[model samples]
Target: MNSPRLAPPTTWFRMGLHRYLGWEQAVTLAANRLSGFRPVRAVFATASRLGDGIGWYAILLGLAWHDGLVAFQPVGWMLGTALVGLLLYGAIKKLTARPRPCAVCDGIRLSVHPLDKYSFPSGHTLHAVNFSLQLTAYAPELAWLVVPFALLVAASRMVLGLHYLSDVLAGALLGGLLAMLALLAQ
Candidate 1:
């Protein structure tokens, strides 16, 4: 008796990848609807813009200004980790080349312009989580402020129609891992 031939990679992808991408797109579209409300759009738009780097920089500057030399070590650690995260994020984005939800999906409206052309793992979420975790490690007291802001930054990626759920999840997981590794090294 002859054994059955296995399906090719293309066939397997056609059967599974399309379905998964469809589900992701559906969820992304649903989340994008939240941007319809002016208040919601405004809030997330601001969060997304800040997540671009200004917010993190301001936090570091404020800490330094407030605490002077005491803030130097933590600030240095955060900045170093952020630089690593940016390089890794850029490499992955170039490899994946996944288009932003707003670019590919109908009914997904962008609340704010994207900083980059493609989206896979969200850079904003990655930096937010990484920075938040680093802050928590250095100054547990600041968790109350940084944690919520990190969460808002992650949510803003989807609500702003810049990323899918998987992208945000991946970013969070990667960021957390990177933070853990960096903390351990310290």
Candidate 2:
């Protein structure tokens, strides 16, 4: 028998991915393919920064402050999910220790920089999805605006070559689920 396995499914699934995916080849392909697009890079860079922690949080807090109790309650849920997403995705990144695409591929046009090293789950996307989805839960009217930003932020991770497509996808799923969990906890 194979002696043992830890994180068996994760390992096998990653291993089984054809050579062009979730690894160096894909990063190279994506970077080389995306590197020439200055316009896309610029847009994604702005979206990344605007959707990131300080940017989005400022908007939420500003809404809370301006709108009085009406906005405060939903902002509360948004903040709660942000906290839960922070802890949850932080742990997953630590555990996965996946390298940022920048570490391996150079063909991508660099735009906004990342704050951390690992790349299994895009932290920006995590917060983006978490905050926006939770906004829908407690602040429905704002969802139309926030949801589109969330999608752009997710795409930005890949466009910047800060993450693989899978990383963005995983972050989206994690964030959505965790946001729901946070709401249920309340």
Candidate 3:
């Protein structure tokens, strides 16, 4: 009997991509130069929070008044993504004991406080992908916006030296799978 293949070429490719992304020279350049646009980064960060807030409001409205249309589209997407994101985050953290890039790689440094836990799957990347997937489901017309932003968030994690490329890929896959499963459940 043949043993199951674990960590295939795609996995290796992703790992290599992660290394390239986590290279200190590029990260330092982005952190020192591109990050100077504080306003833009702040806006992007706040968008994620706002998305969560919208999800909460929708849930409250749905339970209190039994109305699913309050903020309708955006809220629905937000709620769906949040549910999957939270569940997958727990699973990834428990299953993968990989450390954050900054923790394991001497070649990379973080621009912010280092996370002290497994990094095989990035929570931020998961959340971003979930949001993008949900948005795509809700509004097919916005495919162009949703796809690129999702990719950008995943890339940014590695560029920021917070997560490896493999971590982001795992996160993206898990997040997307969770969203699909949720839809099937309903």
lDDT of 1 by residue, 1-186 (tens): 999999999999898988998998898888889999999999989888888999989988988998899989878888988988889989999999999988888899988888889898898999999999988887788899899899989999999999999999999988998899888988
| lDDT measured at residue 86 in model 1 versus the true structure, 0 to 100 | 89
Question: What TM-score would every model get versus the actual structure?
Answer: 0.90, 0.80, 0.59
Write candidate 3's Cα lDDT for 1-186 as tens digits: 998878989999999877786574355345434334666455444443433345334433543355346546455556766776777676768877777766766666455453446777777667666666655665566568667666656665665556666677778887777667655654
lDDT of 2 by residue, 100-148 (tens): 7778665655566777889988878888888887777766887778888
Error (Å) of candidate 2 at residue 41 is 1.4
Worst 10 residues of 1 by lDDT: 105-114
Q: Candidate 1 local accuracy as lDDT? A: 0.90
Clashing pairs in 3: 18-165
Which regions of candidate 2 are displaced past 4 Å? 1-15, 19-28
Point to the candidate with the largest lDDT. Answer: 1
What number of backbone clashes does candidate 2 have, counting pairs of residues 3 or more apart or in separate chains?
0
**Pairwise lDDT winner, candidates 1 and 3:** 1
What residue runs in model 1 are displaced by over 4 Å at the alpha carbon?
A: 1-14
Index of the highest-TM-score prediction: 1
Q: In model 1, what lDDT does residue 147 have?
A: 94
| Positional deviation of residue 183's Cα in model 3 after best superposition, in angstroms | 3.3
Report the number of clashing residue pairs per model.
Answer: 0, 0, 1
